[model samples]
Target: MKRRDFLAGTAATGTVLASGLATQASAAEPLKVGFIYLGVPGDGGWTYEHEQARLKMVKHFGNKIETKVIQNVPEGADAERSITQLCLAGCKLIFTTSFGYMDPTINVAKKFPNVKFEMCTGYKDAPNVSNYGGRFYQGRAVIGNIAGHMTKTNKIGYIATFPIPEVVRGINSAFLYARKVNPKAEMKVVWVNTWFDPPKEADAAQALIDSGVDVLMQHTDSTAAMAKAKDAGILAFGQDSDMMQYAPKPRISSIMDNWAPYYIQRAQDVMDGKWTAKDSWLGIDTGIVQVGEISSAVPAAVKADAMALHDRIKAGTEHVFTGPLNKQDGSAWLKAGETASDGALLGMNFYVEGMTGKLPS
Candidate 1:
């Protein structure tokens, strides 16, 4: 069911009761599961993927579980209230699917020790709270290679959502791979500061196109940039979802986050009373970070090379953050043959060498 419809129906019927209470009336009642979404599933990006996984999970356990979702829940105090409502409404497991919900998830988990909480793209945990994210840089390297080989103007545009480590890591990974394949390729980044704002994303894409960028990439969660790139007759990559409707012209490829396996496993764990607080950061190697099909617009040779890189990364034969690399100031980071550690990547704050402009403070 669509989140909006479910919410409206629940509000109209006023049936927000705890599961434990329902179980008293009928011991066969299904376990109550809940989700907090930063945006509606219709956004067709981040939340859409989560919503798909949620449906898959529900189907996997059919009559064994029931789900309640609250859409468009912002971070901070509002997130806390939404989470608390889920707990009060009898959700045995709750997934807070956004980085900004880290603190709020942790805070609410403290009050509901019996409830299991999972935070996506966050770095915090409690006895009842666990964190999980994808190593999307692996997929970024592949798309970056495509961008490098395809950009006629040698300028690639990136629509960024925020200056957080996740976004920064994507930019660095994409730029490094792009430069590796095409020495003349330069990345031009524009921060829109919001994840799901289509208008802002479109503006950023237009600005980049006006500045001579022929290839567009985005870390934001909308098709706005792709639409803008299409209108300008430029090549682009999709984010989070397949978004193949504009393929063969603008969207030559895409990076997808496959959350089904992880979601199913966590739900099963909760059902078996084996759920634990642990961190899971999966990548292309585990099928969590996936590369969508390369469109026919890409030259056969370029597509082959991109897929070869993808296989190498998945096989652990290549590391995206290998050095000799430097920070934006030309200071040495990883020496030749040395690779980046998870610690460094998680706290990455500076731009890599060859990148222009300051990272937002």
Candidate 2:
């Protein structure tokens, strides 16, 4: 996935080139950027969104940047290998786009101090490494509201990808908002232990539908669940990008992860010699995570309510994990009118109140 080089244009011999322009062109060698993905680009979910952003970065920079990708890279030791290789291959800036890549990215950054690293959805940062992720829970809250109003059965199924804080936060946010709208709503979770397993996702969706789940949500990356929801005449929300093609009705709305702006900014930062290691968790306010269109199937009033909530979040007037929240144990988590802290949310381990089922070890 190397970025194509810029075409070598000829200089008019008679025209003396501007001093800074010539020097800038000569100094601006194509930056080698590397992207590491846990799943293939066609997963149609998380990795797909990341890849889209990478493409956007490429397009924005054109020949000023040369980006390479190592997809289907497993987390753990394998991730270390990919990061090391990318750094060795002259990738000055590398993005490891997976939670599991945290430790590996940090380790590799130590080995290559000059190489800048970005880890997506992970909480590790160093002088050469930074962390960035979308506040996906914000989007989940909107979908949860939709599910509460739309579900024929109060049993909503959530296909979880892993037990990490990111995934758990999404699940809790969905349940919290859904319960607020429909007090009787219940969330059933099925952990697939993988990010983009289509077969497993389909099986989980089938199980949920068979068990009378009228609405489904997933942290897994695939359209299989949406397809299953369509077949079962149930409602579902798109996880990362829009998956409406497979099941238009079932896929009522989606959480679009908009990574282009951030990607462009970071690449431009490098170009301007202003890149730095920092953690960013942007949501509707910054267009990092957006609420997809609410289908006509959703009642006009309910849709309006959801959109209002979306707008409120975008305007920074509301918080997803607001006051009157509790832990799975019924213990006080957030006091009335209190909001959750980013630190607590980032290290979230327990499920919030109103959601049953033990978190897997």
Candidate 3:
């Protein structure tokens, strides 16, 4: 063989090897994902549910992704700062798991066009920002059914986080079902205004108990209300995650929010370059909102009826906000056999008939 021919062949082989190494390096880089939480994972409610979903996603993706979490991030300026930090840190996708983070998510997303943002329990959306939440009203209806049947005082209490449409819709849905099962059932609401303040939640629970409330519901994210109910020897429903540890008594059935599937799908979409901004309000039909097991504390007939209602809703045969409903002022809201539209439910402000007290302006 000629010397020059051998040298040329060796050079070609070296170039090909280096190019192959470069390709492998590029392929080995993992997608970076971030999550912002309103409270600690140990909160045992809303944040716990999101944390569980995150863990599930981690297990599913394995080494294909890297995850970063910022917990207990306040909603306003702090949220914006945390999200921006994640974006600057090279996060290609971020999930802000709280309603209050909506504006901050949008604001951060505008500055990071290449990054995708998902806001939970929020309505706002942008080209890079998607919104999602569970149709918790459906689950709440089941809770109300249990409450209506289980309550000895006919009075139920609701610990509301905020006066937003989301909380209002849950209150109204629970009341509707409670009243349907027991005409004498009445709901009293106490707005704590904070999503995860244990002290405030406990105080609200005590106030409701003092007012003759025997069964309690909450839109806030905490186990404080459950503790209060247990101490008071009353009944309550769990929120976000199953509080079954307190079950068989104070904790009867529960409304569980399952966000694992959604999180995994959205992350997968990001990896596949198919992530798109959209609104998702999934419920029992999609397994996003689940009804926790009804304890033996409830009457067998009541448990059967509650499960039937759950099945009907899941089968789309029953709507939580059906017709034959009226506004708080006694004005007709829905005629018989009619159901509410998504738009109306999204923007719901006034209370339905039979509700007392003024909604915050």
Candidate 4:
């Protein structure tokens, strides 16, 4: 089996327990695993994904990984206090799941080097703390392709949150592929400036619909966008969680991340005393970044093309950043047939060639 396949299979089986039983650990040691969440775990989107991960870790580790999550913690000082409380309560492993937790995570890592820390969607790292994210830009390609084939107006609306690299990359990815199949496609983006504000996110979606955009997509975490799309009778994609129920007919598909495996593995590593500080970016091939169940809203023909693109990406035959592509300003990004380098994909700053809207300043 390929290395990726091996990782997936092992992750599936919950393997990789520690060697050398000198530590004399038990299934009942009550290893405290803490989670710092930016949004409510029951929000049914981004935070829901992480919470699902926490539950799965508990399942694999049984009573060994006692989990505690402090959700809806504000950034900055409030974040620091919440984290300190978790560590002080004897958390052996902690997962801070938000980009805004970057500084606080690093500071806490210094103070609790013995207590392993893992921050999701964060860039900073330390000896005992590591980072993990998925190639979500890859998933965006699927959404763009589906949108390109489905849109009747050839216009798309984006509900964005902040100008971070993660959100920016998704913007570029969807815009590029949408224009690929629909030459007249143009993206209109509105940054709500908050990650999980449902009313604001829904308002952004409504604004897009009012602008005559036939389709919508979001970087924000909420089912509100999907619900708005349904009420407005427009098409959109789901994020983090399968939100098809919200927009039964208008929802096309979603980008699902099965983070449970990673959470389980990391906590197990800390318990086994073999935890290392290496970053990992896993994707569809490894069952980390995933595509949600496609909805009936999409045409059958578009579904075939989307599935093919996914397979090619999984097989390493297609890279979304292939060039002769253009930035929003029409500057050539890559030569024809040239795939974008990993570095450029990681730090993607420009919108793809046919995008109409500017990245939020």
lDDT of the candidates, in the order given: 0.89, 0.85, 0.88, 0.81
Least lDDT summed over 10 consecutive residues: which range in candidate 1? 11-20
TM-score, model 3 to reference: 0.92
Q: Specify the highest-lDDT model's number.
A: 1
Can you write out model 3's per-residue Cα lDDT over 40-156, one digit (the tens) per residue? 999999999899888877766666779999999998999999999999999999999998898989898889999999899888769998989899999999988888888889999
Task: Name the better of 1 and 2 by lDDT.
Answer: 1
Q: State model 1's lDDT.
A: 0.89
Q: Which candidate is the best by TM-score?
A: 2
Q: Would you estimate the TM-scores of all the predictions?
A: 0.92, 0.93, 0.92, 0.92
**Which runs of model 2 end up more than 4 angstroms from their true locations?**
1-23
C-alpha lDDT of candidate 4 relative to the true structure: 0.81
Per-residue lDDT tens digits of candidate 4, residues 270-349? 76678899888777777788877678767788899998988888888888788777777877788989988767776777
RMSD each, Å: 6.9, 5.7, 11.2, 3.2
Clashing pairs in 3: none
Worst 10 residues of 3 by lDDT: 1-10
Expressed as tens digits, the lDDT of each residue in 1-361 for candidate 2 is: 0011211111221123323345674577888999999888788888898999888777655567899999999988999998999999999999899888999999999999999988898787699888999999999999999998888779999999889899999999989889889999999999999888889999999999999999999998999888888888899999888776753598889998878777777876776689999999988877778787777778899999999989898888999999888799999988899999999999999998778889986
